[model samples]
Target chain A: MDKMNGAQLTIKLLERFGVDIIAGIPGGSNLPLYDALSHSTTIRHVLARHEQGAGFIAQGMARSSGRPAVCFATSGPGATNVMTALADAKLDSIPIICITGQVPQSLIGTDAFQEIDTYGMSIPITKHNFLVRSARELLEVIPAAFRIAGEGRPGPVLIDIPKDVQLEMIEFADWPAMPQRECVKHYRKQDILQAAAMINAAERPILYLGGGIRHGNAHDAAIRLAEKNNLPTTMTLLGLGSMPTNHPLALGMLGMHAARYTNLILEECDLLLVAGARFDDRATGKIAEFCPGAKVIHIDIDPGEINKLRTAHLQLVGDAGSVLAELLPQVESKNRQDWLNRMAFLKKENPFIMPGADDPCMPYGLIRQIAALADHETLIATDVGKHQMWVAQAYPFCRPRQLLTSGGLGTMGFGLPAAIGASLAHPQKTVVCFSGDGSILMNIQELATAVEQRANVKIFVLDNTSLGLVRQQQNLFFGKQYFASEYQHHVDFVTIARGFGMQAFALGASDDPVATLTKAMQTQGPCLVHVPIGRNEEVYPMVPPGAANKEMIGGENHASA
Target chain B: MQALKESYPCPPSDASGQKVLELTVNNHPGVMSHICGLFSRRAFNMEGILCMPIGDGKLSRIWIQIAGNSHLDQIVKQLEKLEDVRSAVLHPAEHEVFAKLEEYFQGS
Candidate 1:
């Protein structure tokens, strides 16, 4: 057995677990771990300006790659700064292992400098967290952290290592083998047959895809089930890329801000086959009226989600792909011309169109331009608020794992760092981050990291001079009481990007939008495009809280002729 | 650890109003955090918690007491699928394990 310090052991174990890249910052308490990380040959570290940026960057890699990613931070403020990301990961079920440095064990309770009870603070946010008590525990804890982060219902895991622990010497023995996750049990054939029987009997059925489909990489299976059963499909926000957006069977998203047509079709469906999605409030408005007449067959890997929100007539607890594969074999083919015709007629009557056509200076037009420019392989990540909803409603997503954004958490400041992480993970591909002026400033320091890494990321900042979504809400709900949504001063984003050592282009009212945007997109390494737009630009097709999906306001109604 | 367990007195329970959740999980660091975090995230509070390493130190058993509610069953199902949790069973609130412990403490 070779003798090594605790920090050395931790890094070696992380390497043994196949951790190729880690995002974080160095602090006083965690210097030792950083030292070890610097010495390691297998693991490359990306230095993030803020601990939160590091956390989101790791999230991007984990979410896009379908593998657990790693991040690092120091004690106290570092740990607290990373907390939001931990909660975000927990909400979205993204797998990430976060390692934070702590004060020496002896000073933990003495109110030492840079000391925080990270383990205690993290208890409510992470799937699990550890305060390392001994060097030997790393042999078990490191492997367990990876296992817990990647296993059933993946989420963030934290390991807080004290400085002394990092310095302590231990005999290094053989590392543990990668732990195997317990296999989810296959659904009973009888249950699958029963579900198939319901599917065959129903005249109008809709397949509902959720985030779990992306998590399980079951998009193919979901598409297959829809095609084989002759079912039209609707997606939850996180399930956007499970099938091509333009597929005739695709009814787009349902629920709040859903297409008027999609909601109407859902209202008329007889069978609602929920695949890997929890019926969240945002996706199921006025729960009682959502798919009112439809009998639900909920399939998900998490048993709790099966009947927690809306009761399912048939609950199938297993991997989404496995369950769908099983049901596919038993499903009988059918043709429902009446249902198809109804959907077509409804779509024609209530076309889901937004403003900004032929005007690249406008919000919707800019999104369309970005979509048109984006290669089929390009990945898009968005910040929270109106931009997120607009991208979800407008972007043409043809594959899973392509759009990495915070869904359940609705986290702002998720775009730049996540795109940096995605860019790092896939250096060959282009990664675009769509952020608003308000959301972009939340963690703008990450632009430095992107420039340092020379990450192939294109950042497009939609500057509306206000929190556009909040202003819209106030306008409609609060009698146009704008409040503090608007910014008082002009911020030159191009100067800020250049200050971070990245090339930037500022597109103002007089500039030709297409040429400037195209130049920014085609530039090598990291670049930022700043576009100034009107503060009154609202994401339309708005649904008031608790309102039924059919009660949509704005969008095509407010479109300028 | 045993002394710490005894310091906190167990609250009384009524069968109709209370619920008991017994879980068996692989014994390892952070398992407790994972279990407790789930309930906290759901905004549910545990009336009492009892945990100890079981058998050969490879696993442990935990019992959590929470108020009975319409969402209890769904929460139990979620607990059963937690990363290292091998099993999660909802015991009758009248189960005397904690009650017996409380009785012993009072006698002593």
Candidate 2:
């Protein structure tokens, strides 16, 4: 009379949560979930080579889907392997539900070979976590896991399903659809009006956009307000593509590595329009000195963010889409022609310098070519270090959540698994993971998982033969000692990907890489593109940590070391 | 009378000067998100936020500082009525301490 079994209950829950694809690696304790998954027609399982890769794929999927993605592994070692990605997801605020099969409840903490405290290990990184102690609680827990993972500014959640419990039969019940989501509230209105007045009356009003606009689908509304109110716009790295990059009003990514003109304009602006973007340390260096002369118009959906560390004059608390829809018409047009003209002058005055201009295939040039071939909705995930920053700068994104990189965490080996998640989330969309050689080696075994899953996640390796970021730092700060920075061994990521059943390619060109990337994009199944980038090249416009944004250095090509 | 009044003019001031905002919410799992998400979702500028634990671990108290309020009536109040939010109050401090901090930052 029970609903099939524990595995069936989990499968049913997965269907309910709209999980179409899962990236996982099965083992001793997790066998039952896999057994159930195999029989289930709705949810597809993609086996990863390693647990960490599986975690990243789930992360990628969750970021793109705006829903929790799933990854599975057996207890102990498998669960431990997933820790790095879980922490990475926590920092990026991606919603992924990690389901690991645990040893029988009785075997827990008995020093069993595969027995480990999976729940305790995940508690810190997960927004919420659970340990399914009984088969009877299966239905509630499955839905509960999703509820926690998907709602209220989504983040990762973990569910440790014991092997014995997973195999046991249990009754099923339909839980109510009321998502136990947290209420959304923020600053009072009388004060919000007070803030907006300063902005409307200012001579130079500039809008600094962040990821929230895309998450809220408030892009059009933002543009309407910007155009109507004569407000120029700048985007955060995550906010890239929220507004079109080519728009005359778009100021591009602004911060340490931002265009000199963007930072200059932001510095001189009289009124700063900040929306849906956190004043992360990277974005606003020397916080006190940031926007020194500007009056900030703060609008956000979360109250806690309004004044955690940054000051704003006015505040709004509502979904970006809903609030912008309401307030767009209320904006009064101001003729800030002088401001626009000055910004234009700045843009013309400071052009980015490129490294290896004459060389056929420079790293920056290669990334630009890759971008050109990339679809409007093609999802790009990058590993940590200089390659990640390069992708952030070179990729022209037009969609929200389209680019999923380890921003807050900056974890290496994050790209491939996240690519798996992104690809699984959107089977029709192209998903590319941009990783450095060193980062790829960290979880390269997952290439087998990609082969098994057939998630069509492509990878691009920027092989520079060293820990590029570390080497750069060591060169700049440590007088080029190169301690723990240089790696003598080079990885043949292309061959490795091919051996793991993926298609592979290599490129060496100075101009755009559109043609090669277009070919790669056309391929099916897992693929890897290996590009040998120069080691000395650095991501320029550094703020040197604890410095003001105005203290940025270098153009694209200035010698890093 | 129309309940929605056209509040003319966008209020302007540098809100980054930091202040305290108190929020009361039902004890719930997503309360933190509701508080944090609002800032990210609406493009609000936030600084020095502390969600110090409060009352029976059921109610949450929040302190936030911000500058702009374009959608205060339209958004903030509605959020308060959501399942989690019980009340939200923006406390304006015109005290000498706040004044002194401002003067210190201004290098006066």
Candidate that scores best on TM-score: 1
- Candidate 1 CAPRI category: acceptable
Over the stretch A1-561, how does candidate 2's per-residue lDDT look in tens digits? 446677777877788767888888899998888888888788878778888888888888778877778989889999999888888776666778888999988888788879988876675577667788787777667776677665544567788988888888755555435246554444455554565567678887789888777666778888888888778899887788777776788888888778777887888888887878878888888889888898777677655466655777666765677666656656677767888889888777776555654342677776777777677878888888888887777667776777887776777888877787787778888888888988888878877777776867778888888999889878767788888777777767777777887888877642445566777878888888888887888888677677888887777333321
Candidate 2, after superposition: displacement of residue A172 in Å?
4.9
Tens-place lDDT per residue, model 2, B4-90, is 122222233334444445666655544666556656655655654657568678777766655443344334443452334566665
lDDT of 1 by residue, A419-496 (tens): 999998999999999999999999999998999999999998999999888899899899999999989987899999
Candidate fnat values, all? 0.39, 0.00
- State the fnat of model 1: 0.39
**Per-prediction TM-score, please?**
0.93, 0.80
Q: Candidate 1's error at A487, in angstroms?
A: 1.2
**iRMSD of prediction 2:** 12.4
Please give the DockQ score of every candidate, comma-separated.
0.27, 0.04
Candidate 1, residue A318: lDDT: 76
How much does each candidate deviate from the true structure in C-alpha RMSD? 4.5, 8.9
Stretches > 4 Å off in candidate 1: A509-511, A556-561, B1-17, B24-40, B48-63, B68-70, B81-86, B98-108
